[model samples]
Target: MQKKVNWGILGLGQIAHKFVADLKLIPNATLHAVASTSGERAQNFAAQYDAVHYYGSYEEMMKCPDIDVVYIASRHPRHHENTLLCLKHKIPVLCEKPFAMNGVEVEEMIAASKSNQTFLMEALWTRFLPTTKKVLELIDDDVIGEITGVKADFGFKAKFDESGRLYNQNEGGGALLDIGIYPIFLALLLLGKPEEIKAIASIGKTNVDETCHMLFKYSNNRIANLHASILNETATEAFIYGTKGVIRINSRFHESTSVTLLLNDKEPKDIFFEFLGFGYRYEAEAVMEYLSKDVIEHPLMPHSFSVDLMELLDRVRKEAGIFYPTYDRV
Candidate 1:
């Protein structure tokens, strides 16, 4: 018999909406409850999604007997605490990306998960997307022989709203955590942890990086260039350049729909995949599969990998002189 996992959503934001929509597309998942700081807001979100239960506080939802897992789609600042709360209830958690403010916080969450013996994963949905899977297959097969270099960029001209999360120093806001993570993740996937990391950024008046460029040098003589910006828009595409061929991912590479491979003398080949609506289902499915197998973390997006990624981000911030309020306690 198949077991269905009931979910309790900790925050009802745009990403949470997408997660709920994707959950409806999966067979073994159910939207059991939702919690928000306000009862009216929780009720409204519940009514829109037809969720069975709603709570004004996360503590109430975590204590609910129906919820088998808790999905933390709250702001990046709250991921660590929300994850700990779920672990306290012995419920598994799938936390949103930029897992926490820094590596120290991530270590704490990981330690808590270990102590509770619960399943926990970063919601880096790109790793589980079908298109990204195919790209990995090509890389593993040496279709793009000995990746010489990789280039990726994610940027958009987000208006400067002082009150917005992107510009606020208190919310762990900045181009780095808000949009830079995608390009950084792409580079890390192609070339593990870089031997040398150097970065330059345009610091805004608020002290947060508004535009950033990063260079990664790998031990195997591979190089990667990545960029992200909030002051202007870029292609948001990615290219994996190797000796024999190159793989070009479409715009919004993080949630890519297809990729093109260019060979030495042959024409480009386009490969595409149909994704479940909004694409969060893949990661959600990964959580279910890992839990059913009694695994504490996902192999594809392991906890150690997540920690390394956070450390890299921490280094970048240190170099760029961008500090958040959360860093003090982190």
Candidate 2:
């Protein structure tokens, strides 16, 4: 039998709860430890998740032995620091996305991973989803002929709260970095880096982009139109256009379980996938597999990819004028 991979999670936020629940779905993955700034919250989270250990402070958690990897589920601004802490202790890390506030921090994180010889991956869960695999397969097989354009959007109505993470500039709040990343990820995956990016955003009272619209023009004449918003609810679907037809990712495309294929002079077909948990298990499983192989990075979501993604985000922020004073170095 394969040895189980012991997991540690930093931060006790909502995303952390969802991630731990998915960890249960992987047979070889076990929740060994959890840590939070609040001692009571850490203890409570540990109890709820049945973690073997819990630490009130992140620094203390780093000292725990036999933790195969640590998931940095902290807020956007903390990702760089949290990841560096794990790498400093030679602990592998799977950090939540928008990997860091900007490209410079991402580069530093990559450098740390290289210097420490430890595994590191940006937890862009959508990249590992079954639906994504199918979409890629279809594109590769020319189910949709030579791709020409892509259009995707993700949005939700968020109540304005000046102090909440979603609207607070200090917390890295903004639709572009929060929900907008989904559309951006899809475009980058399908279209590569845009040669020229044209973007504009609606900056809210809290100094964060409430809505962001991006147009990416590629050298090969391919184009991508992407949008992200926290002010209104959108279809949240993704459409990949090609010379022959289009592949439509169903609503809430980021976590979508189904996709529809529309071919020229053919019928529209819907593809569906069934899975346990909230779809985070796939990335966790991938990390464990890479760790077993003694690899330092995930091929599907490599450090280079994270670097490129962050750099692209920096460009978009520059164009949109979205700045987080505490974290923005670009």
Best by TM-score: 2
Residue 145 CA error for candidate 2 (Å)?
A: 0.7
- Candidate 2 per-residue lDDT, tens place, 1-330, comes to 988999999999999999999999898899999999999999999999899999999999999999999999999999999999999999999999989999989999999999999999999999999999999999999989999999999999999988789999999998998989889999989988999999999999999999999999998799999999999999999999999999999998999999999999899999999867999999999899999888899999998888888888999999989999988698
Task: Give the alpha-carbon lDDT of every model.
Answer: 0.89, 0.94
Candidate 1: residue pairs that collide: none
For model 1, the stretches where C-alpha displacement exceeds 4 angstroms are none
Give the lDDT of residue 41 in candidate 2: 99
lDDT of 1: 0.89
